[model samples]
Target: MFNMILRVTENPVRRTTARDIAIIAVFAAITAALGLLPAIYLPVSPVPITAQTFGVILAGAVVGGRRAGASQLLFLALVALGLPLLAGGRGGIGVFVSPTVGFLIAFPTVAGLIGWATERVGAPYRLLPGLVVNTAFGIGVMYLFGWVGMMATTHLAPWAAIVALAPFLIGDALKVVIATLTAKGVHASYPGLLRSRTARAVAGAA
Candidate 1:
């Protein structure tokens, strides 16, 4: 049962290795560092454009589903513990009640979803599918949760959240593309960064 929980896909013994743990920690730090970038706030929107999501997207692509989720959860746990790792240096328990709370809560889910998508789509392919997959799950599901959070916290109508999110569409698309390309490149160059299903099976056999 524990193995089932830890399996990246079908193989259970993939690695509770130091290497896997290191990748998770490094990616968590990467997300925090990216969050330190100055956010670009549009006059009309409450959420700002920040680089943290770039790390969020890449974490899944590079680390696979389980490790990616761990990295994101670790980042969130630190923020909740007053690490000041969020965008604009805000942190602690108060963050869960903010207007942007939905996005904050959904961060781990986003990384997991992206990693799951990457695992299924299979890498080293033509990237258009990855772009589509990332955009669908990453941008689409992300905002859906964010929109729900906005309405819940801000007491706004559904249309208000939908309307406000309009400014972010283009930039997020670009992010999806960048994340897909970068992840694929990393996979091609260093296949061991994450073991594909085939790769894992082969390793297990030998």
Candidate 2:
């Protein structure tokens, strides 16, 4: 019974395909492109608010869990290789050790969790549920890491770090709304995209 329940709820792991690779690459590029948007520096926090997170949310919302996560991982790999893919055109192995590392590392997890949760919402994903999933994972979970990153780098007390992180919440909230709406539109136009990878694999084997 436990196995059956797991089987029913869990996304079946499947082999990656060329299409998956293409999708991952495309989303990674989309994320990098968003970084080109001017970052808004906040006097309160060292981390600047950028549009990159919007791409992160959209990747998960549109691509489902594994691919979304893969896309983020790919993006980071390029950044790590010294590509100026981050906001303010900043990138390199050095960025990984900086105050923003926690938030930066959280990208893949954020996208993956959002994608997985979005998939559970099923086809024709609606606006409210999408908003809820994106908000919870994208902002709440993502910030949890960001807070730790701030503390680690700046040596701030927990409360102090939380206070510093407060300024970005409003901006993240807005991104969540826009990403959710955009994802809903995408799913509406490209039905089954959330399940595309799995569906394709199943179809191919038949």
Give the best candidate by TM-score.
Answer: 2
Model 1's TM-score against the true structure: 0.79
Error of 2 at 156 (Å): 1.1
TM-score of 2: 0.83
Give the residue spans of candidate 2 off by over 4 A: 1-14, 40-48, 196-206
Give one digit per residue, the lDDT tens place, for model 2 in 66-93. Answer: 9999999999999999999998899999
In model 1, the number of clashes is 0
* Residue range with the least summed lDDT across 10 consecutive positions in model 2: 5-14
CA lDDT of each prediction against the hidden true structure:
0.80, 0.89
Measured against the true structure, the TM-scores of the candidates, in listed sequence, are 0.79, 0.83
